[model samples]
Target chain A: MDILRIATSGSVDDGKSTLIGRLLYETGQVPTDRMQQIEESSKRRGLSFTDLSLLTDGLISEREQGITIDVAHIYFHTPARKYIIADTPGHEEYTRNMVTGASQSEVAITLIDARYGMLEQTRRHLHIAHLLKMSNLIVAINKMDLVGYERSAFEAIKSEVESYVNQLGASFTLHFIPMSALHGEGVTAFKDGLSWYQGAPLLDILESIKPRNIINAEGQTNFQVQQVLRPRGGDDPDFRGYAGSLRTGSIRVGDEIQVLSTGKSSTVVGVHKWGTELNASGPDQALTVLLADDIDLRRGDALIAKENDLATSRRMTASICWMDEQPMTSRKKYIYQQGSFSTKIMVDQIQGTVNLKNGELKSNHQVLLNEIAKATFKSASAIPAIEYQEGNSTGAFALIDEQSLNTVAVGFAERFA
Target chain B: MKISDFPRSLENEAIYIFRETLAQFERPVLLFSGGKDSITLVHLMLRAFHPLVPPIPLLHIDTGHNFPEALRFRDELVEKYQLTLHVRKVEDTIREKGLQEETGKYASRNALQAVTLLDAIEEFKFDACIGGARRDEEKARAKERIFSVRNDFGEWDSRRQRPEVFDILNGRIHPGENVRVFPISNWTELDVWNYIREEGIALPSLYFAHEREVFYRDGLIWPVSDFIRLSQDESPERKVVRFRTVGDMTCTAAVDSQAATIDLVMEEIAAAEISERGARIDDKRSEAAMELRKQNGYF
Candidate 1:
């Protein structure tokens, strides 16, 4: 069964959690005991009906405050596929959290309150989806019941969202679903509402939408060695395999590959996966490979096809989403990590920051938390990397704080400078 | 090449997490409980660092209420993989801390293992501890990050967690602060059973149907073991049963079943309505039991 990773993005009161809860309840995925638990909690909180929001609000602070503060991983299964919904916060300050959800998701559901057609927070979400390269967009016109289930109301909201997305020039499989998450109409099962609206229910669309297989880069073969495996004792003294997951493309025995960082080339002699030898392996396969010749390779090294033109760079420009409370300053040193490799790098210059609310780019000298900025960075040592548009895993990097070691920012390589 | 050349998704993900732990942490250890989930973790660890013995050691917190078969399985795996095994006992910790173990009807050592584990972490100064926890197992775990950071006191502050985006795991932490890594967080209970069946991994005998001395308690089957103090009304009876999850024998209940093979076990799980954690008596204390335990340093 395929796993469909989805991210739900919308402003507060847009009913992301309620829709997810209805999805779970309608699909019979919510067990009886769990439902009883939710009911009791809802009653304690003086809710008139069973508050679905209480289901996804797992943290104590979230329940006490009655708002989702972080990303909650909600899982449900249909006959066709399994779904992992990364329900993200809708507040503007939680843009980093929204990016966190969008980064791993193939589809993004940007909800629109029927009363409020489209808001700045909605545009902010769509912009991040574009930045993260989300392939699918579901513009769910929620709370149709509040508007008397009028067809004109749904159409207006849908076209408003379509124009906004088109204005942003994002190419995603656009879907529009009109539903009331609270009343459970047109969500998992269609109920008596909006007879003029003719589209598959939100749950059906979610199940039918095939998650784009993107474990690796598109149209490119890239492999990063995560670890070096050498026989410890005489049991397999001759075995020296490069253990790593294929970021993209495929590799087979006898395939000549280049060590990108070192410029050394070697032939694949064997491909082993969990005691089973395979003739070939492709993206996301965590396998071990033996080379025909002995070469020095360590973790964070890249192994690509001999013909590919991946650059070895000491300086590069990338679009970074700042995550830490501390502002990013020029000439400040941090650990730049891509794939499994980490190198000391200094911020050269802050090009500009994106005004997330309006999608405007402003020349800025400092990058603050939850802001997206294009910045040039200079590394102390040369490293192999690619542009984010070229390949996500190969091109994306994270800045690690020297003191806290917390991931301060997420960056996508734009060019080798 | 066919897409079949790609490794299974969940297994591949677990391997990826294992590799990340090895790359990021200086002193990392795998928390093994001799349960199927931990067993699966060990298997993935081997694959993650194939052609060589896994560099990390195995840490087992013995609650002293474990089944004999589970201990035997743990020993065999440690020897087979040539892994360094670290065993911390709750009984020892209770004696040293002058802590009182629960008694009477709800007596159990399940929660006490958390103190033992915290002590072990402090003693060894391990920066990362890999666990086999899955989100589908419980609700609180559903909100856990893949690289969950614990403070110096090993407390999990859910509201104050680092935002993890994409495949990039933030393993950064200050000294004395440790990270609890859950590689199989996305996997469901059925996913685990399916993987075990596909891989043909060995499990403890308790997972299979066998005749055991058991007693009825709260509509669940309780095993007659050393740690359990049976009441006069609760007499031990022979029953054919198997364990869905292996934990402290005093707290982990058994389910009535004759399914001895992996295929039958899969069938039972598919048709079963109750969750795997439902059989865990410790979780019956309250609605927020797991969350409270997690806040206080329980894996």
Candidate 2:
């Protein structure tokens, strides 16, 4: 079975953890011991019923404060597919954590409290989901039990969100479900509530959505060299192979390829996966490619189909989400790492920061913690890259503070400047 | 075109991580515990550097309370692969440093293994310790990153964790500090079993069901071993049982089953009610037992 990655986002008290806990429970993923642990934890808190949220709130500080602090990955499975859910914190200050979780997810489940309607955090999550180009957005209107499961309460919030999303011109397939995660209503199946709802339950909607594979997209072959495998002491003596995963498109034996860094051309003599040879290989498979000609190719070098053109530049404009408490300013130097490539880069300019409430780019000189902004960067050396919309592997990069060595910002390349 | 297979995808991800660790770190070692998870890591590492054996050595922090079956299996594996094996015993650390050992029933050397591990790290100056930790196994592990950094004292500061994006991992660290690399952090318990069955990877005989002297305790089965101090009232009974996870004899509990093969084990796990870690007695000490151990450099 294939894996389906999902990210959950909701403000405090919206019951994100409860929804996840209910999903795990309904799927029979929660074991008896864990169930007992949560039951006892709930009892220790003096609660009459089991508080399922204790399962996802794993951190000590989180349990003490009764709020999620960071992203926790929850794994479960059904007969059809394996599920990986990133339970991201919904607090305003943890937007960077949300981005980090949502970056690898195929679907975004945005939780909305029925009583409070649409809040700023809800809009912010939706905005980030859109920015990440997520196509499936499941808007779970949670806590319907408090609103009496009224169709009117659901419709009012639905219309408001519908108009706002339309204004943003998002292309996500929105699936709205009204239910109470605490009571296990309308989660896995509709039971004793929400008779007015016509859509499938939350679990069904999740199962129906197909995980997009960028590997199959029609694009140029891009393989970033992760390591050069040279088993000089084995059965065969002179063996040199460029080892890496195919980031985009496909590659076959006898295919002519060009090295992006050295501009050297070579023919693919063999494709090897763990010493076994294959005629051809598809994307996302970690394999080694042996070249007919001996060319100097090292890590941080890219091998592409000779005919395809990948942009190689020293300057590029990217939209970045600042994750560090120290604000990002122009002319500050950091390490820009894309795929296996790493280079020293200077933030040339801070163009503007995106206003989450509205889809507007506000002019800003500095990007504070958890804020999203567009900026231009000048790398010390030219490197191959693609537009973030084109592919994920070559288009994304992490900015690291040279002094602290902490990942300060995650940026998506918009275009080469 | 060959579509990506589920297990193969996970395998490729793990292989990528293994190669990346080798490329990034100056000195790296695989933390092997002779458990199914670390055994799977060894299998993947073998495939990662096929013609040539994995250049890194294997480090095993022996608690001296381990099962004979696990220790025997560990030695045979090292011999078969011609692997460089480093065994540092907690028994040695306790005697050499005059460390206090826990007394009474339920006292375990599981926690003491961390001290031996940290001492080993310092002795060998290993920059990266690749482990077989999976996020699905525990709640605290769920919040940890693939490249988790630790201080000079081997303390894990969860609050100061660096954000990991996409498949990119940052292995950069300061001197005297090391990163704990988990290549199989994404694999679930079932996923490991499924892959093990698919690949036909050899495991210890303890994984399969056999008649063993065990007794009931805390609604769970406990094996009769020399290391564990059984209560006066407790009596050993011969029953067909198997271990889901292989830890020290004092902490790792057994399960009553008749599954004598890998297929049966997988089927039993799929139908089992309790989680894999449920059999681990160390985690049952307190709600934050695993977290506390992890913060203090427990692997």
Candidate 3:
């Protein structure tokens, strides 16, 4: 079975954890010991019912504060697919954590409390998800029982989210499900309460949804060399292979590829995975390619299809999400890393910070923690990059503080010059 | 789809991580525990650099209170792969460093493995320690980054962890500081078992059911061994049991099962209600037991 990675985001008390716990419990993924632990903890806390939120609040501080502070990955599997839920924090201060969770996920599940309509934090969550280019947007209007399971309340919130998503110009598949995770209504199997609603339950929607093939859009092959394997005494002596993961598109044997750094061309003689040779390999598979002519290829070098060309420039405009506590300023050099390549870069200008309230970029010179901004960067060396919309894997980069060595910001390439 | 047609995405991710670690770190070592997860790591590493054995070595911090079968398997694996193996004994660390060993029933050297591991890291100057930790195993591990960085003292600061975005990992660190890389952080226990079954990877015999003298305690079955100090109220009983996770004999618990093969073990895991770590005695100490241990440099 294939794996589906889902990121859950929303405002605090939106029951993101509870919804996840309900999903796990309904699917029989919650082990007996964990269920008992939750049971005992609920009783100790003087609650008559089991608190499913206790399952995802793994940290002691989170349990004490009754809030999620970081991203916690929860895993479960059905016969159809293995699901990985990145339960992200909802607080505005932890927006970076939400981005961290949604960055690797293909689907984004935005939870909305039925009692309260779309809050500012909810909009922020949706904005970040859209910025990350999530293929599927699952809007789960939870706590329907709190609102008396009224179809009007669900419709109100559904229309609000739809209008806002339209303003954001989202390109993903939007799905709205009304459910009460606490009471287990409309989660796995729809109960009798929602007679007005006629739709598949949340679990069914997840299982049936296919993760969009973002890589095969243009059939543009972008492979970065991570390592070079050479065995002198092996059966085939004088063997040299360039090993890396195919970030985008597919590669086949006898395909002509261009080395990004040197601009040299070579024919792919062999495509090997593990110890066996494959006739062809698709995106995301880690394989080694044997070039017909042994040209100079090292780590951080890219192998692109001869027909495709990546933007190579020392200046780049990107969308930056600041993650560190220290505010970012201009002319501060940071280590900009994309794939295996690393180079020193400085933020030349902070164009504007994104207005989460309206999904618009606002003029701002300084970026504080958890703030998203559009900025231009000047790298010490020319770098190969692509638009983030075109290639998520190859277009994204991280900026690490030179002194602290902490990842301070994550950027997506928009244009290169 | 048949089991053979299962998606190899997880394997691809793991191999990608292995290659990244090899390229980034100068002196990297795989923390081999003779468990299924670490065994799977070795297999992935071998596959990652095909036609060439992974240059990284294996480090096994031997807690003396280990299952004999696991040790035997470890030796056989090292020999089979012709890989370099480093064994640092907690027993030796305790003797040399004058570290106090816990006493009484449930007293285990599991916590003491941290000191030996730090000492080994310092000795070899290993910049990166590749582990088999998965997020689904426990709560604290769920929040851990794929490239978890440790201080010069090997302390894990969960609160100030660097943000890991997308597939790009930042492995940059300072001198005397090391990073603990977990390649299979996304994989669940069942995923590991499925991969093992698909790949037909060999594991220690302890994973399979065998007749052993065990005693029931605190709703768990403890093996009757010299390392464990059993109380007088508890008596040893012979039963067919298999271990879900292999750790120190004093900490790892056994479950009653007749799964003697990989397929049977997978079926048993799928049907079993208790989690893989549920049988572990150390984690039962408290809710933040793993977190506390991890902060002190425990793997």
Candidate 4:
């Protein structure tokens, strides 16, 4: 099944969790007994209806505080598509979490309250989504019922968001949907009772969507070999293949691929899917590939298209979201772990923090926790960095703490102009 | 469509966690109980580092009253793949007076395994322990994180969990502290069966149909064993049955099944009307049995 990954962002009490829960419930992905528990809890709490937010807010503290503390992954499948919702906390301190969820997501649904359209938290979420290079965005103007479903209120919010979104450096296809998660107005497969609006339901919009075609500009495949399989006498002999998932582009039988760091060239002799043999392999196909020519490639090495060098550069300028409690310091030594490869790197510069609202770049020396900033920094040595704008695996990375060995921040290497 | 072609977000997340554990921790072990969920976890661990040796080892905490097939399957997998297999026996723990064997018809040593597990962790100094716990199995598990922290005494502090965001798992454990990692915490029981069938992974024969000395107790098929002592009112008998959950034999119940092959077992699982953990008598011991077990580091 084609996966539709959506990252949801909004402040607490904006009904982000409720919207996600309603989407899953309307799609019939929730188990029956689990639903019964929620029903009973609602009754105990003396509520007239079940609280859908309880589904995604899974942590013990979150339930106790009635807020999401971290990014909890919630999965629900419909007949048309399987959805993975990386539900992030809406608090200002959790901006790192909002960025973390947005890093892997293809589409971002930024929720704004119709009663309080485009608050500080709303701008922060939208800014984080844009900075993460999320291609598709939906500006969900939520809680129309609270404001008597006023059309003017919805329109005012829509234009205000569009005017801000149009100026974003990271361009995203945008849409606006006005709905009330409390009353189940337009968030699911339900027909719009308010005929003031004309459009597909949220489910239809989410299901019919195909992730934007990822065309690696230079027509290349960055097949970094993770492991080399050499069976001495098991089954077949002379069977040597560099095994790693295709991280960037596609490779077919006749395509000429290059083994980076070695300058060796070979035709794609075969593509081995995890257990099954295949004719071609593309991005995210965690498979083994056999090249006609035997070349030395280990973990952290890239197999680029013979002529395509788009993702092979070593220097990177990136927008980073600091997640650790420790503030970002310049030239601090840390490990740069991208995919299966880990190498030592030092942060050379702390460029500037993002203003978020007006896309204004504020010059700064460093960033603190939950802060987003764009920096131009050189690797301690040299490492491969494609623009995080293209490849999912290569373009992104996390800075490993030198002392604690914990990953502190998720970063997107800025695309070379 | 090839299962490999399509990826479940939960499965990808689990694989990522498994790899991260291998890369980050010094000594990690996967707690295998010979159940379908753990079996699926084994397969995922294998694929996570395919072409290379599996990074970590597999540990089985034998309750001694396990089905013969489960024991045999554990050995076969070790011998077949040349995997690092470590077996810790509860029988030894009982003989050494580390745990007391329960008495009476309703008596079970399911809770006592925690003591033996803590002993093993202390012996090995394992930093991270991975298991096949799923959220849908129980309420507390649904409340767990991918990387759950444990104290020096191997106790889960429910009040204090480091926030997990994106793929960044906080495997931070202070000295003498260990982390309990559940890679498949998001998968449902059906996902495990589907993955096993899809991958054609080997499983214990006890999961399939077989003749076993069993008796009915409290609407469950209780395996007849010296440890699984039966009531005077009931008689030991042989019946065609299979274990749905390969927990401790005293608490683990058998379900009536004729399906033997992986495909048939999956079909049966899909059509079955009961939860996989429903057959576990230990869980039925209390509303929060699993939660308390987790707090005590029962992984």
Q: Best candidate, DockQ-wise?
A: 3
C-alpha lDDT of residue B189 in model 1: 81
What TM-score number comes out for model 3?
0.96
Q: Where in model 4 is the C-alpha error above 4 Å?
A: A189-196, A211-219, A228-241, A252-256, A262-277, A289-296, A311-314, A415-417, B1-28, B45-56, B91-115, B125-130, B134-188, B205-244, B250-292
Q: How does model 2 fare in lDDT?
A: 0.87
Query: Least accurate stretch of 10 residues (summed lDDT) in model 1 chain A?
Result: A211-220
Error of 3 at B207 (Å): 0.9
Task: Identify the runs in model 1 with alpha carbons over 4 angstroms from their true place.
Answer: A214-218, A383-385, B1-7, B231-233
DockQ, 0 to 1 scale, candidate 2: 0.62
Candidate 1 lDDT for residue A190? 62
lDDT of 1 by residue, B156-184 (tens): 98766777766777787888999999999
Per-candidate TM-score against the hidden true structure: 0.95, 0.97, 0.96, 0.84
Candidate 1: DockQ? Answer: 0.51
lDDT of each: 0.83, 0.87, 0.88, 0.73
Between prediction 1 and prediction 2, which has the larger DockQ? 2
Candidate 3: residue A115 lDDT (0-100): 94
Candidate 2 stretches greater than 4 Å from native: A214-218, B1-6
Per-model chain B TM-scores are 0.97, 0.97, 0.97, 0.92
lDDT (Cα, tens digit) per residue for candidate 3, span B194-257: 8888888998989999999999999899999988777789999999999999988999999999
Computed on C-alphas against the true complex, the DockQ of each candidate is 0.51, 0.62, 0.75, 0.25
Query: Which has the better lDDT: candidate 1, or candidate 4?
Result: 1
Fnat per predicted structure, each in turn:
0.51, 0.60, 0.82, 0.09
Which digits, one per residue and each the tens of the lDDT, describe model 2 over residues A1-417?
Answer: 677889999998899999999999988888888999999999999999999999899989889999988889999887777889999999988877788898878699999999999998998888777767786999999999998999899999999889889977877899889989998988987778776677899999988987666334446788778898887576787888888878767788889999987678999998888878885444567888899998988887889988877668999999888899999999999999986889999999999998877778899999999888899999998868677762255688899998888888888888896
Q: What is candidate 1's lDDT per residue for A43-117, written digit by digit as tens?
A: 988888999777787777667777677788887777667788888888777777777777778889988999988
Instruction: Please give the C-alpha DockQ score of model 4.
Output: 0.25
